[model samples]
Target: MILEYSNGLHVGGDSVKAEEIPNSKDRKYYILARLVDGEHLSYQRLSNDYFISRSSIAHDVELIKALLAKDNVSLGFDNSGTFISGGEIVKQKVIKRIVTDLLRAADDRSSILKLFIDSSSITRVEEIFQKQVQSWQLEVPEYYIDDIVISTAIVVDRGLLGHHIADAKGNQLGSLLFQFDKYPLVYELIKGVEEAGVYSFTPDELRYLSYIVIGNGFKFFMKDLQIPASFKSKVKLLISTVSDGLNIDLTQDTRLHADLTVHLYQMFLRLQAGTTVINPLLDEIQENYPQLYGTVWYAFSDFGSDNHIAISDDEVGFLTIHFQAAVERTKSAKRVLFVCPNGIGTSSLVSAKIHRILPEVSLIEVVSQVDLVRQDLSDVALIISTVQLPAQTVPVANISPMITTHDMKTIMNRYIDVSMDGSEQEVDFSHIHSIPFLAKDHVLFCNAKSRTAIIDSLMAMNEWPNAEQRNMFRQTVFQRDTVQSTYLDNGFVISHGDPSLVSHSCIGVAILDKSIDWMSNRADVVALLMIKKEDRKSVEPFMNVIMNGINNKDWFISRMMEISEHD
Candidate 1:
């Protein structure tokens, strides 16, 4: 018998055992009344509310569970307690199934089925049929039932097919489909139109049609017709049919020139659709008709359109400023020396102004000509000097004596920082003890050849007093030349590799008293050599300090002239 159980009681049919079932009528009424009042019931509270033991309530719950399972219905427990699960239609199915079963028990299955089918309960009928088919394992033939009924129901109940038939040219199609809670009946209708030889349509027309199909179902003839290959031709026939039905005269109206206008609209739609097939067709048309393609693509092109305007002027300017600032920041290092002629107070003012602006830079006093000649400053990293010092001296920034404070800041920031915080102190080189110079019997002068021969000869001769001391000497003098090629402007290439110069363990100095017609700059130079193997390492640091120290323009010139005079 068709009896539906809700909670713990039989609801619809007489076949239920009332004595075995709990009287859930009061419970159902109470729960429904509470729900109506914006209150909900819980399973635990329900047990306590009825004044029944929990086990008795559990027993009643089991019977109700079995009854609901027969109709594929369920009850769920949440913060609201036991509630009917699934859609409203699912609950309706349980009720309808019970009614149908009761009718069957009364031997009225045919009348009940007829009543269900005749009613506007298409969804209920489908659900009942599906349940029966599933339960009995019946093979229901496809196409017997109404496809539109099922499809439309699914469309309305659950969103589907919306994306397929949306107006592709419209920007909000994605957002609209996302909010779609119903199945896309309109999309299906449009697909039917496509099937009925109306594939081509203007975007506006498609949008209008979409609204119509969604609001009202399509006409029977529209659904029945098959699509033609030439959609424009089909659309012309349609427009003509409509015009004829309305008896409208369109002799002067180009819109009534259905074939041409419809075809153009269809082409516009295709372009917006971004269909892959159209691109190849366009390419072929251009190739076949070069003059037409040229007119369309180039000659008649509108350059004044908003899309063609240059858009990045402000953005480019912003990027240029950002890059300039970054480069200026990167150029700023620490330690600088300023050198200029005396009596131009501009250097002092520039240095003072730079110090005020950039506390990070330490402004050393400007060195005058006298100071540049006599100052023994070898610790400076950058020399910001207006005076033209020789290149061998140091890396210098040549600035005018009339330079502004801002210009001085720019120069100091570009080259090195003059004012550094005192936390980072300068390196102290005071602990490195200097060794006394030892006299040697045999001295070797290197022009160019094998340095290895010179080293070997020095070791064999033992001319230097100590091996340890001698090795240090060789390092300072010989190995330094290997790091960089030594070239003198006097056409002489002095390197440690000369074999003729290898027989000594002592370093010797040679000087040219006058400028030689030797190389590009015509520089006559003083030459120095080291001839000891054990002294190599010690000799390197010593030479580095001396060469770097003598790189001061005034100091180098004075030392060179002193050697030349002695020679």
Candidate 2:
């Protein structure tokens, strides 16, 4: 006979009931939690607790050990039972993942607390956190409250179980984040945790709790004003360096300055707390925008050293995103010509509406259908008309008198692909950087004896799909070099190939351990601007950056030294 269970779970035996049923995933989580909590979980005890067969429990333990190994943790056996051995940070990550997965698997929020923490402890943390946020009159997002509470619960559970972040026996905490150290609200939150009387936090744990508070979408009103002076100055210096190196003045862009300052403040705090924010687009950015990535990486030389901290490529990728956006903001908007068969008033309305919808685009002119054919169409990047138009080189968008949401999306998607002027348009440096081509790993410092070895080394460093593609890329670069030297006068060469040779647009840079001769020019550094032939325009801005630097050799050499020194 078959049996049914509450909450839609099921079993095949008549004897099994809702309360008695067990989820194998839940049991695995329980086992992991026990190990993480420093409990001696033997096969016998786990089987008895879960009312599962000893064999089944043993299999689950082995599966968990395999999983732990993936996280750089080890599950070992002793005379007593099973024990877990790993650094505190690794343990914390595993524990958090276990709780999170359980929460998702159960499709219930309370499952995590029931499995790892008591109701009273959960209630105490929630109440104290709520009162503290309220007392401080801080505006934290409503959804973030649950995350804050969960993080607090994990801290309390781990702290009481002897996984202390202060003593941090097997783990190293991030360098002390000074920005939030002196905040009065942080002290209040600590006081609330102590008042609970169930557990106390060390200074580091308290700071971490504050990190939880800030990390979960809490935006302080004074965040902009609170930017550390030294941090701001360093960011300014870097931006200034890039501006001077590329001859593109970024300082005048107040919007970029303000936005970058705020991002750096939050990023610095996270770094200080040893929490590295993950950038999902790191790989794509590295492969596509190699030049921009290398340039930005050079920009922030004092990033980790000044704070006495080590920064990860993930952090550098995040910073690249901010600077990339800033560069795009400075570019001229793509010009689009609007047409209407109706009177000028209707055309004017369409123009105004399109402007509101696409603030990034410049509405060059409003022309009648006849005028569209008659007027100079050479300047137009796109043609938006109420009526159908004759054959045209530029993209023609046909829409109603009033542009709809669908119409707006159509224009945005097509505009990027269709350059207004038929022939390849002059590159918008700001626009090209919008989709990054370089990642941190693509740029490297190499010790090569000759130009050929350096080229070979770079080809090996870049992760191509196969050896065939690498050979083609290497041959293409060499063939091009033979035709005419790609070397610039100032100790550098810009090596590149047709788009078909490269899977994606990227720039790989190598600061040679020693100088090498290239035809007539002798150089120690080489930049390979590998791009898909279709994306040849992206090379223009980078070439301009190098040539601009070439104009001021001292400026270029100084920047190159910064890169070599960091290497």
Estimate, for each residue in 95-196, the C-alpha lDDT of model 1 and write its tens digit: 334333433354643423332222233455355435543554534333212332332222222212121222334543333322223434345443443444
Predicted model with the maximum TM-score: 2
Q: Which stretches of candidate 1 lie over 4 Å from their true place?
A: 1-416, 419-485, 488-494, 498-505, 517-521, 531-534, 540-567
Q: Which runs in model 2 stand beyond 4 Å of their true positions?
A: 1-151, 168-182, 188-200, 211-228, 241-248, 280-302, 355-364, 374-382, 391-395, 402-567
Top candidate (lDDT): 2
For each candidate, what TM-score against the reference? 0.18, 0.51
